[model samples]
Target: MGALADNRRFWLACNLVTLVLHAFGVYLYASEGFAHPVAQLWAIVLMLHMLEFPLAFIAVRERRIGWGVTIMATLIFGFTWWVPTRRGVFHA
Candidate 1:
């Protein structure tokens, strides 16, 4: 039980960090612009965030919706930061 709680806390912390980084990436992209692939990837990630709303609703009604939102949120957060950095969006 203690291990599970710790794992959840770790994941939550990771999620929060990812969210903040993703927000920073969005700001950087808007202000500085990004390459085609980076822009496309960010757009897709934003779309996934939007898509999670409906899934979240479903999850509210069904306990077994499979943590899809949590997973996608984490992925979007990581991918957004990685794609931009890899594409030299922040090369200054």
Candidate 2:
């Protein structure tokens, strides 16, 4: 149906935007060499990048709870993993 097509387009657009942001974050991190202050933030962004695929899969399958949990896990992972690395608690 038309509505389904429209929804798909919307999701596609969202995914594109997310990818762009992730790519930009990567550029910033790589070019700057992942120093303090920005490293952790970049790490979180990277983790978010990793979560996109699984989240999209759940979304496309219409699994609401799965999508929610995936999103939450992404956030947790990003903060825990990325933030610490930025603070120099971990390397790579």
Candidate 3:
């Protein structure tokens, strides 16, 4: 699983899926609100992602990444973005 995670294609697919989920979550939350179980779940997931920001901040600082990009990517992809980034797997 660790080896699979190092693949760029794998990360790309993961990020895309994450992006789609977030988009769907936003739409659902806006339309149906937390009254829907799925929307509530997505809201919880989003909150969890927000909680991950401090960790992302620490990991990304050493790489000289700008705060805005780091925050957005971490919120969107969580470990999918930060883990590979910290491991230098995204580089040649």
Candidate 4:
């Protein structure tokens, strides 16, 4: 793999970490009701991710991807998942 591929992998790994953190944050909020500051931070991040959802929806639609998977992936990975996907990097 070249530099570009390595860069993409790095971003993908970051995305994975982001996903895990968000999930854990949500779990904390659900279980503890914002007792932790992380849970409060998660709410803000979720809102930001919600804003990214429409862009992800359009990108996935342009690629003729299914709505269900697109929704889940976009909610989880946001720009890191959709940008390269739109550029045909994953297919390449």
User: How far off is residue 66 in model 1, in Å?
Assistant: 20
RMSD of 1: 12.2
Please rank every candidate by TM-score, starting with the best.
Answer: 3, 4, 1, 2
Worst 10 residues of 1 by lDDT: 83-92
- Spell out the clash pairs found in candidate 1: none
Q: Could you give me the TM-score of model 1 versus the true structure?
A: 0.44
Best candidate (score: TM-score): 3
Which should have the higher lDDT, number 2 or number 4? 4
User: What is the C-alpha lDDT profile of model 4 across 1-92, one tens digit per residue?
Assistant: 35664476776787888888798898999999888888988877767777888898787676887777677776777777777777665541
Candidate 4 lDDT for residue 50: 74
Each prediction's TM-score against the native? 0.44, 0.38, 0.83, 0.74
Q: Which TM-score value belongs to model 4?
A: 0.74
C-alpha lDDT (0 to 100) for residue 26 of candidate 1: 79
Error of 1 at 35 (Å): 2.8
Q: What tens digits encode model 3's per-residue C-alpha lDDT throughout 1-92?
A: 77886788888898888888778878888998878777777777778889999998887778888899888888878878887887777641
Error of 1 at 18 (Å): 2.4
> Comparing candidate 3 with candidate 4, which one achieves the higher TM-score?
3
Query: Scored by Cα lDDT, where does model 1 land?
Result: 0.50
TM-score of 2: 0.38
